[model samples]
Target: MRYDIPIWKKSNLTLDEAAAYTGVGVCKLREMSNDEDCEFVLWIGSKRLLKRKKLDEYIEDMYSI
Candidate 1:
């Protein structure tokens, strides 16, 4: 079963949207964002957003490892 969130439909996704799209926890994504190597997070003022393309690339890299 697929859960299609409206925010996930966008190119830029918030932390929650990225979590839903990746089947990963929001906390994990936040943790990744804290890593110096993870440059996929976008900061707009105090809000954080993740690029859907970057998240997809991250998932692909994880599985390819």
Candidate 2:
């Protein structure tokens, strides 16, 4: 058996993956995730994960960030 996670099928994404998926810079994604007001960040220990669907909703709602 084999399992593969295509980007669109993921519920969470690493900064690198998020950058590739959204065309956002890794530094910028990190910066945004660090914000106290950010709505798309998920923390697992010290690792920050971006919520894929929420991120899509955020990007869709944003004119600029």
Candidate 3:
């Protein structure tokens, strides 16, 4: 079996990059990062990064509901 991944999902993404890639807006992405239940967000020092794969999974889960 084989799987294919989008180019954007090949690495971690900063908040702004995530916004552009996911089209979810910067403010909402920030809110999701602060929300305790959001599992796709990661914070390092003062910088926030989103795991591209996790963000894709999260959006998929949301729409499956």
Query: Each candidate: RMSD to true structure?
Result: 5.4, 1.6, 6.7
Considering lDDT, which of the candidate structures 2 and 3 is the better prediction for this target? 2
* lDDT tens digits by residue: candidate 3, 2-65: 7676547557788888888988988888887887777887778878888888998988878532
Q: What would the per-residue lDDT of candidate 2 be over residues 1-65, giving only the tens digit for each residue?
A: 98788999999999999999999999999988898788999999999999999999998999997
Give all TM-scores, in the order shown: 0.74, 0.90, 0.75
> What is the C-alpha lDDT profile of model 1 across 1-65, one tens digit per residue?
98775764788888877887888898888988876566687888878888888878888878542
Model 1, residue 60: C-alpha shift (Å): 0.5
Candidate order by lDDT, decreasing, is 2, 3, 1
Cα lDDT of candidate 2 equals 0.94
Q: What is the C-alpha lDDT of each candidate?
A: 0.79, 0.94, 0.80
What lDDT score goes with residue 52 in model 3?
88
- TM-score leaderboard ranking: 2, 3, 1
The 10-residue segment with the lowest total lDDT in model 2: 31-40
C-alpha RMSD between model 3 and the true structure: 6.7
- Comparing candidate 2 with candidate 3, which one achieves the higher TM-score? 2
Candidate 3, TM-score vs. the true structure?
0.75
